[model samples]
Target: DVKVTQSSRYLVKRTGEKVFLECVQDMDHENMFWYRQDPGLGLRLIYFSYDVKMKEKGDIPEGYSVSREKKERFSLILESASTNQTSMYLCASSLQGHEAFFGQGTRLTVV
Candidate 1:
């Protein structure tokens, strides 16, 4: 079974702080994605990587960045965290044209 692991289940940070959310997948998939979920906006992609050392910006890449230095690991960085950036962040991994396995998610609150 494929498993996605998130470093934290919840996070709290002060405004203007830098934050890092880490994720890892056991399935050795080539594609990994980072998304932020909000009430009305649903799941909005923040970034994705198809291969190690390669990354692409997704729909809502503003204020977000991603790194995929290893095949099974992907990291999301919030350059400068803010109150409006508070949301549930999800990490997912999958093969091309396949359904993704998602992590338990990290709920972030900025104060």
Candidate 2:
């Protein structure tokens, strides 16, 4: 069975600090994405990577970045944390036209 796992289920950081959120997939999916979920905003894309070292900026890329050094690992990076960045971050993996598998989600709090 395919599975997506997140490094942390909950995280807390202070303003101006750097944060790293990690996700891994057991199935080798070609597409990996990073999204942030807020109260009303729903899931907003932060980054999408299709191949190793290849990335595309999503809807809300500001203050965030991503890395896909390997096929199974995708990482979300917060350049500098801020209060406004507090949200639940999700990671997903899929093959084109296939159903995406999501991680449990990482709830991040920026103070």
For candidate 2, lDDT tens digit of each residue in 27-82?
A: 88999999999988899999999988999999999999899999999999998999
| Clashes (N, CA, C under 3 Å) per candidate | 0, 0
Model 2: residues >4 Å from true position, as ranges? Answer: none
Structure candidate 2, residue pairs in collision: none
Model 1 alpha-carbon miss at residue 111, Å: 0.5
Lowest summed lDDT across 10 adjacent residues in model 2 is found at 37-46
TM-score per candidate = 0.97, 0.97
Off by over 4 Å in 1: none
How much lDDT does each candidate structure score? Answer: 0.95, 0.95
**Which 10 residues in a row give candidate 1 its minimum summed lDDT?**
60-69
Q: Residues 49-100, candidate 1, lDDT per residue (tens digit)?
A: 9999999999999998888889999999998999999999999999999999
TM-score of 2: 0.97
